[model samples]
Target: MLAQILPWYAHAAQRTAAAPAQALTAPARMGWSTHVGFGPGAEILGRDLRGKRLLELGCGPGHNAAHLAKHHQAQVTGVDLVGLQVRRARSHYGHIDGANFAVGHALHHLQATEQTFDAIYSVFGAVGLVAPELLLAAIARRLNPGGVLAFSVPHPARAGRHPSTDDHARESHVTVSDLIRLPLARWEFDAHRWGAHLSRTGLRITSTVDLRHPRLDPWPTTLLITARTR
Candidate 1:
């Protein structure tokens, strides 16, 4: 399933790479939701991250990783499936003191690396794109004992779709510039279901945050979940 989506992400990388480069500075604040400053920020991870080992799954363009490394002084390693995206990340943030970017599958990278992280996070990244059970299990193996895992996904209600009762992924589309739509598969689950999955994978749920649209939308636009490895 992930293999099928690589080309789409690669195309997206190419398009984004061609655009004018933004200022090479990390964001002043970290955001978990699609909307800027809508939900909880970096405080979800902790008040301080200096000297911490961190991993970011599906770190497109490495912006968040850069923010963590530059602002919080974390040793952040970012991995993405698309090579072009990885290159773009390196080009943009490679000079940051504690930030590094690599190209590979999240599961494979997590399993292959010998090092363990203090925290592993995904911001609308691999947590939803990959199979939950497999990815969560791999994350558990890569995290140090009592480590943190935080990720965000589109709220099921945002698309007017009910959360899946089972573990299978549902078909979805990634809209680009309101013109190009790319096919993809993503898993959607309510907080209870996600808690169950995390528990089964040896992770204890810490908190869940629902970020509703600013305009009083009926449903939340993003759901952020945080867990700790047991």
Candidate 2:
């Protein structure tokens, strides 16, 4: 696995230097495959969020927030690290009541927020952007007592599936492929690892599902995990 991703990680470093990180990440909406990946998990998450507070950290463009608002009728707040992405989210979802967007770092803001959420959902957004411990602590701080948090992330064991069809052994060798690049990303936590972090933070893992299947992945992506705060 390491062999497969070495080139890709090398490539990602160069790309990270070239383009703004936010620009490098495409808007995750607007594709058929995306519907399958996020739609199913969102549906499950939405069910838990009915009449509840839903916080979507690292929301790319507020698409999922819109779903929670329209379908679940939950008070939703979507946050992103990049200002541009947050701007996009606000525009895309301006009309959805109980749905709002902000640009903020997840772990950082939690240290200050007096607000606690009913449920938290992150669809490949903030899960891999920081250290797992920091994120887990942040979740514990921001999530209401007994609140559940769910996320979809690249299954870490499958991290090294890089293709030779790309540049390698050079400074400019970043591959955007999820399998190779995500493992070498600035921050990445597989669902299991994140769950471990949750445990340390006083949250109990209630249930989990491997989102890796023919329907949800070119890489390993898992689904809703309902964890209760202790």
Provide TM-scores for the models: 0.93, 0.68
Total clashes for model 1: 0
Give the range where candidate 2 is weakest over 10 consecutive residues by summed lDDT: 163-172
Model 2 residue 120 CA deviation (Å) reads 1.4
Q: Looking at candidate 2, what is the lDDT of residue 118? A: 83
- After superposition, the stretches of candidate 2 with alpha carbons farther than 4 Å from their true spots are 1-39, 46-48, 159-192, 215-219
Residues 60-83, model 1: lDDT tens digits: 888899999999999999998878
Q: Of the candidates shown, which would achieve the greatest TM-score relative to the real structure?
A: 1
- Quantify all predictions' global Cα lDDT against the true fold: 0.85, 0.60
Model 2 Cα RMSD, 1 decimal: 8.5
After TM-score superposition, the amount by which residue 86's alpha carbon in candidate 2 deviates from its true location, in angstroms, is 1.0
For every model in order, what is the number of clashing pairs? 0, 5
